[model samples]
Target: MKGLVIGGGVAGLRAALDIANAGFDIYLVERDYSIGGRSAQITKSYPDLTNIKDVLKPLMEEVYNHERITLLTNSEVLGLEGEAGNFKVKIEKKPRYVPDGESCEKCIEVCPVEIPNEFNERLDKRKAIFVPFSYAIPDGCVIDETNCLHFKDGSCSRCKEVCDGINFDQKAETIEIDVGSVVVATGFDPFDPNLRPELAYDKYDGVITSLELERILDEDGPTGGKIIINGKEPKSVVFAHCIGSRDKKVENPYCSRICCMYTAKEAYMLREKLPNAEISACYIDMRAFGKGCEEFYEEVQKKQVLYRRGVAAEVYSNGVNLVLRAEDTLLSEPYESAADMIVLAVGVEPKEGSSELAENLGIKMDEYGFFVEKNMYDPVETEKEGIFLAGCCQGPKDITDSILQGGAAAAKAIGLMGRHSN
Candidate 1:
């Protein structure tokens, strides 16, 4: 049996490795130029203290070495046809704009445009021809066709000219493949803060999302681990939870599982960095439902991290510092405070293309946009016989949960392969 997994993230990679090891040929497709997914964007993971790459690298290495797995990057599943066991897939592969002959990242330096790098979440910019991040598993350069001058107009093919004619101008290509099974592990997107007008996302300089905060704390991130606000050092900090989630009236109603833990992690992280600084968490209710979660919350509170149980009605700027006016429902009083920084514990939503792909493939999607499947007997199996779901593509799940689900999906696929061979 042959299988295709539609993501290169932790879950997809894990599933690919598992299926390949079971003697089934596997094809792992990653939309991005690299395969780390959102997991690669993080620093050290909480509770385990494992570096993001440390957990991912070994599996990535296995995927690289595995003869049965075909990994494709900057490629997308344009369309899907046929039934579970015998499926025809059409994929669109974006041109790399660079020849495989002795490639180097020098093409990035020659290009002058600096676009808001998605890997850095606009905290930094990358040249048009550049890798997503430093540790991109392949650590190779990718051409941002949308941003490249050549793609913009044929006149300025600086990347091609500077390459000493080693550059290839092959047009973006599409190809078709056949697989017996498929696994959908496409991940989720963070709820855009711009959707919340009350928070004034674009207007505030100090306010950012948990993801932006991660970049700030990361050694490779924008600030280089300094909690600097608009290039100035400010004292107090506030983390607001449920920005665009857990609300039936406004944004998404579902509780984003990772927010509570990440919020606690941020509080602890901030306190560790600036011991004397004031750090507060404004939340409706703290949910720590993991092995060491409650204890970790205790540790944060014990370290003088203020856990305010309430919702911020509005956030506005008073003068130099951003003012947050929130009622501490626990205390039954209106409280206003100022902070150097504010981090919104944003929620994750399905990736942009998931629903469209589901329809094209005749799969189903839940109202929330995550792929819906026959989860009763085996949670990961999809409505289609050989298709499986894993990672945030199924729903909002943490990294550990994603990894575990990836393994389970692989087992399901392999079990099917085993039965088919018999």
Candidate 2:
């Protein structure tokens, strides 16, 4: 059977590889120029402590090489029609401007756009055209439309003027395909830290997200694994938990399963690299539920890392310092801590397009836009037969649970194919 998966994240990539291994033709679509979704932006995973791209590289290689799989990068599923056994998939693919499969390094060197990379949350800057990261799935440069000179009044095409491999005629194309099964695992987005004004996230130059901090601590990231913030090494760093997550009134009420583990891991990593700096994780009940999760958290606690059970009520600046005001529930008293930098373990919300895709396909999603299952026992199988939900698209889950869901999605997809007696 021919199947189409409309996401290139961990879960979608995992499903594509497994189902393709089962002898079915699979078409994998990714909106980004690369296949490894947000996970690609991270340096490592927690609890087990493994590099994210190291895991993605092998899976991506499989997706790239499988004879039964057709990979489409820099594309989005524009529309869906028909259902169940047969359907038409409409896709919109934007151009990379660079010639397909051509090695183009000079373009990046010559391009004039020098803005912070969105993928790494502004930790670093790359030219207008750049691989999302050094180890990006395709490992090639991409043309960012927003900053491209072609869109900015056509004044400079220095990249094109330098690159001998570009094609001026490369235009976006919308194509339609026929498929028997569909998988939607578009994943989730982090809550905007700026929305919570009391936190004064954007107002201050120091506060950042768990994702952004991950990049900063990464050896390959902008800071080269340094605990520096705003041009200086911070004497103290504080991680505030449940910033945009686990709070219904602010951003989301979801647990964002990966937060606790990441927070603990961040604390540990900070201690490993900055033994002299003060570190504390301000959280409301650390939810460490994965295998060896509790032990890892204990390890961070034993490192003289302060585990203050509390939610920071507000953050404001004081004479070149950021002040956190909150109640330390364990002490049952209000307290304030001055920190050089703040890391917000902002919660993960469903990726921006999850709902629009669900509504367009007539698939069921919860009030929050994650794929809603018909029953909890069958987590992968959604109300739409032959279509499965996996990863954070269903709810807050760590990488372990997401990988398990990936395998389960493959099993569910295979079972549906078997029912057709093809």
Candidate 3:
């Protein structure tokens, strides 16, 4: 009557902790080298501007230190069989190459291979052997075998020579376990703005996605939290909302549900950093539905951040500054706004491999690829008896809703397991 939770984001963490505290053994599986998920990558949470690390780090630590919880990083569920109350699961755990808790970081400084650091949204370069972030759970460096020279042609051993913790011989292992119920908390991926090429996301240095902006706002981030664009503070910054959401052109017509408020939050933070810099946002609509969110939007407006009704139609550089063209739906006038930096308020999408995972777990996915639930009233319960849904894997949602769903799923799992035991 054990429990299993997949995806180690905040939602997954909450599910695991809840089940563990309910006196059930639970296994938490994360596909990445670390377990923090997208929440760890963010600088702050909206409406209240709470430092995300303060919230995430303690939760991660509690999960890692919990006796009834087995934190499995760099792992994925390979298969699930049997029925509710007696499910067999197989997990594939990839080797990190660097031993956990034994990394001296000497390998990083000696490694010659440099690749774009995805953790920082490629704003900086990292050695082939590196950790995902400063506070990554199961803290240690991981070797990117794809880019490591030693794996290519055995051409480099600098990292191995500098650190005794590097283990080139380690291989992936498969673990089999039996659980009463499974919770799918695999999170969402930020909308790739490149899909909308007219915005010139890849064509200009001044353009960046909202997630990238989060990294830049992080003090521990690549630029040391400086709002520097092109090596200098910008005179103006403009945020464009609904890049991949609420648009029929991309087939993602659903509102992302968080972009408007987050954009407002980012604009508010930008005002704090660059008090004299002109700040404005172009949006299709203002949806501040969460608790305190509407008030926060008003606070941002008080900070002198201008909000206009429109969606960016096109973005191009005019040899000096990046120019954004849009139609102000409010005034029914075509306009162009030039800014030193343009942040795209990208939407959320289902995780790329969600469909495959749903099939593997014997659950249904909606047309949009989010895991289908039992009904609107029972949002956390999946169509499958032993399976439950949590977080954005079910659909687009903010952190607060994600956590609530996680707890609901955990309670469902615990009840099922308890009934089976009885």
- The order by descending TM-score is 3, 2, 1
Q: Against the hidden reference, what TM-scores do the models get?
A: 0.96, 0.96, 0.99
Per-residue accuracy of model 3 over 322-387 as CA lDDT, tens digit each: 998999898999999989999999999999889879878999988788888999999999878989
Q: lDDT of all predictions, in order shown? A: 0.83, 0.82, 0.92
Among all candidates shown, the one with the greatest lDDT? 3
**TM match of model 2 to true structure:** 0.96
Give the lowest summed-lDDT range of ten residues in model 3.
98-107
Q: Where is model 3 more than 4 Å wrong at Cα?
A: none
lDDT of 2 by residue, 1-422 (tens): 68888788888988888888887888998888888887877777887678887888888877887899898888888878887767888988888877545556888888888998877788778788777766665666678887888777787787777877776568899999987778777888888988789998878879888898888888888888877888898888888998888888864777787888898988888888888989988889889888899998998899988988899889988887998888999999999889999899888888887877887677887877788976988888888777788888888777667778887888777767666646
RMSD of 2: 1.5
Please tell me which predicted candidate would have the highest TM-score against the true structure. 3
Off by over 4 Å in 1: 99-103, 165-168
Estimate the overall C-alpha local distance difference test score of candidate 2: 0.82
